[model samples]
Target: MTKKGIVLWALLPFFLGGFAQEAYFPPAGGTWEQRNPKESGLDPDALQEAVKFAGEHEYSGPRDLRLAILKGFEREPYHEILGPVKERGGPAGMILKKGYVVASWGDTRRVDMTFSVTKSFLSTVAGLARDKGLLQSTGDRVATYLWDGTFEGEHNGKITWAHLLQQNSDWSGTLWGGHDWADRPPAEGGIDDWKYRPLREPGTVMEYNDVRVNVLAYALTHLWRQPLPTVLKRELMDPIGASTTWRWFGYDHAWTVIDGYRMQSVTGGGHSGGGIFINTEDMARFGLLFLNQGTWDGRQLLSPEWIREATTPSTPNPNYGYMWWLNGGGEREWPGVPETVYYAAGFGGNFIVVAPEEEVVMVLRWLEPSQIGEFVRKVFAALP
Candidate 1:
């Protein structure tokens, strides 16, 4: 054989090994495989230390989520419980290396409210609509498709799908008795100041507001001509082998008529109330799917291009994407972690962190929010 041919053959196994190490999918209904920490290039003792730290730092909040909601956002004017809220479980999480469980704590099967982590799932539904051609472009003005006065005003009419996905729409108006100005209002401003505040141009500023998030949910529901939950189940979750226990909900008065059938518009978070209630295992599965760049068990459930677009940082917030939080090496970046890492974060310390370069997916629930950066740094310290 030629010298070139011999060299190619010598490198073949290295390329094959890379492929083998990159993909692993747990079965739909059976037990997830657990890899020995040492075999997975991790220090088991250090990993346990991380897990212990997570357990010890459980969120110090009322288990009665309703009271927690009220007290947590007491400064916001007129913030009341408008949707379903459930008591959360103690610290429960799973750390996965190449889709295999490396460590887990608490009850991974217990279902609980995931708050704004639901926004990531909601963002996925929008991506599905884009893929299926239900909607055209993220850059398209929402007013063009939703002409029902939701986006009719001059400022709101300029709002695009990209704006809502990035939480920068500055779209005005109320939905389901939740006023746009009442959510996480400015620390210095009074009611009138916020209510009559000049609207920032869409996509220029990132403000975390549930009312505006719910507006995105409302628009996606209309575009899909059905409940967003139904779309998510049929397209993403079911295909991902997720269990039946997960649920998405909206406010009590969020019912709307679609195709002559009444359907409830789901909320994108649990701030006022009602969001995704799911288990840690399912959350891990979701993170795994994104870690694999939108493929599941060799099937492409979401487009890789869409996943790339979703994780790409928006202009306003360097640490934010299309509903996902990024480690953009800015103020929010975990000190020693990679800038490529992104996560889905929610109230009361629910997080699904995806680290692509490390080939890891971690679902951490009910850890104190302040300790997330420290917890992640510990986990990474265990790596080879």
Candidate 2:
């Protein structure tokens, strides 16, 4: 997002005083208990319109997603293990009010690749690292940790954990066989043009590059001394009672030797292939964790301060924060959604939207990008 296009939302506490939310943690193991629209504070018609609007807004992008990723994008799939992804879900969703399942549609149980929503999970892992002192500080240069070439050279040496998390690292070099420039190539650039381009100063420019995000993943894995998926499952997932079905994946090529053992470096998206494949129920649980400011079941899984830092507008990009998307009010991209809302957005229209003021945690998978804001509005219309 451009600097001028971003919006900063400062919330007023009074606006949230009316909707007194009650805690309702779902059972960790089985199908979540459901509540009717009235019980959950939703207008029946408004909730209906939300799903109908999402179903109307199908993937309007180019037809062949795989071909689009490979050729025009020149990015390879993380692995060929999966034969084919079923047709993307037709606007699957689950609405949680006060942590109770208010309404749901489609198959919430289907496991689908959540693309960049994985980044938010990755960021949460980073927060965990800080909590455990794995990372002394976000401002510390990553070169100080790994002496490898990944953080060597002029601009890269200055790249900090914050830079990597916020997409301001602008870190040079290639990893997992994907170059930095390969993400969003210039209108006029040949292969040579992209490969040899000058590096943007670290923590200066915010460019959305999967390779850079992957770099963050690799570095975090090294620091955690284990696979990110393992860290996530043990630290945050299990504690919050997330299911065993969700999985985090990395490209087959993205492997590194850490602590005398080789481990896969997970990426943040399904742009290539692997990321986080999770069910909507699990995604909603994750969202609810954030909605309650990282507290789940009276336990502080993620520190409240970390959530603030993760959601705060980065100097480089107001629309992003620690791999999470900020919903400060803007003219586009969730225009009608409340300013206090922050969400984990991914490719193919997977979104985990959290509206704290409304006590609403919503998950929408495989909906149209243009209709996300409208869907959120429909949800809000249902509430007071």
Candidate 3:
């Protein structure tokens, strides 16, 4: 049998038995017909050229150097992990390193929904606000900035900015089922119904919920006096050369409500449940920026300290940091990840991984949400 066939046969059992079954492989050229490159104003040739350039140049850093070397020798196993995703059925995937599109096996241009990964980007915005003095500190109570009467009760009043950032708000609600009591409009009754129903106090446990993050979006927009997307575009996205082809899924609609007082109320409450979409290259650029400590080609887009702290594990869970995810510390985390590697991972496998020690950044996008953890680990292993 040929070498390629042998490799496939050897990996078939592992691919089929493990989490790889859920992976969605992209076409060889990384083109997604659903979201065509031309429609998004991207040149496929240029994208390929960029990837080629990245592959040619060698990167030397503390952690990912070996992976880089393996890639340089063309001996790295890129195709193995991607094979299942391609044949079995999954989303398109892309792999980037150091601002270069090194290898892509599937539809790379498609803009898939990156579920909670939006929280990581939003956290960066919040950090910017704090760094620029727009936000005092993570310790500042949310009530200090938002209208006093907006959030009800002691728990809501006492909930600090840091609490929200860490997902320790102690708010008893889930954003997925739409059954979260905290999601109810204030006029309907107020948060008093279930705001303080937490089984534990704030900062004691980590619960992944989107309502708290939505509230954070509301708080930031209220403070900045602008929409979240506008602030991100002007301050963050444009600086990184991100195209405006992205969209936030939930905020696409506008709503108006009539209050009990018969006054028309315009609410901008849909900016939560972060789902921001962008092309593969822009996402890779984001990874590169983090790899370079929030700077790109000499411009300091984000403070170095912020990048450091944001990627560091703040809670007992080694997998979580400011808004990013760390790989080394968690029990069920990525196995081969160096202790220094951290990533901003989105739902459906949108990852902006920064291996500072390795001087590398990797971005991967996939359609199946189930492959997120496994795919990240595979990418980490594939790195030299």
Residue pairs with backbone overlap in model 1? none
Cα lDDT tens digits for candidate 1, 1-384:
999999999999887556445678888887999999999999999999999999999999988899899999998888888889898889999999999999999999999999999999999999999999988899999988887899997799999999999999998998888888888999887999989998899999999999999999999999999899999999989888999999999999999998899999999999988999999999999999999888887788899899999999999899998999999967788988899999999999999999988999989999999999999999999998
Q: Pick the candidate with the highest TM-score.
A: 1
Off by over 4 Å in 1: 1-22
Scanning candidate 1 in windows of ten residues, the lowest lDDT window is: 15-24
TM-score of 3: 0.64
- Give TM-scores for every candidate, taking all chains together and pairing residue i with residue i: 0.96, 0.89, 0.64
Q: Count of backbone clashes for each model?
A: 0, 0, 18
- Which digits, one per residue and each the tens of the lDDT, describe model 2 over residues 235-304? 8889888888998888867778887998888888877778898999899999999888777877888988
Evaluate all candidate structures by whole-model CA lDDT and list the values in order. Answer: 0.92, 0.80, 0.55
Q: Which candidate is the best by lDDT?
A: 1
Estimate the lDDT of model 1: 0.92
Residue ranges of candidate 2 with Cα displaced over 4 Å: 1-21, 61-68, 71-87, 329-333
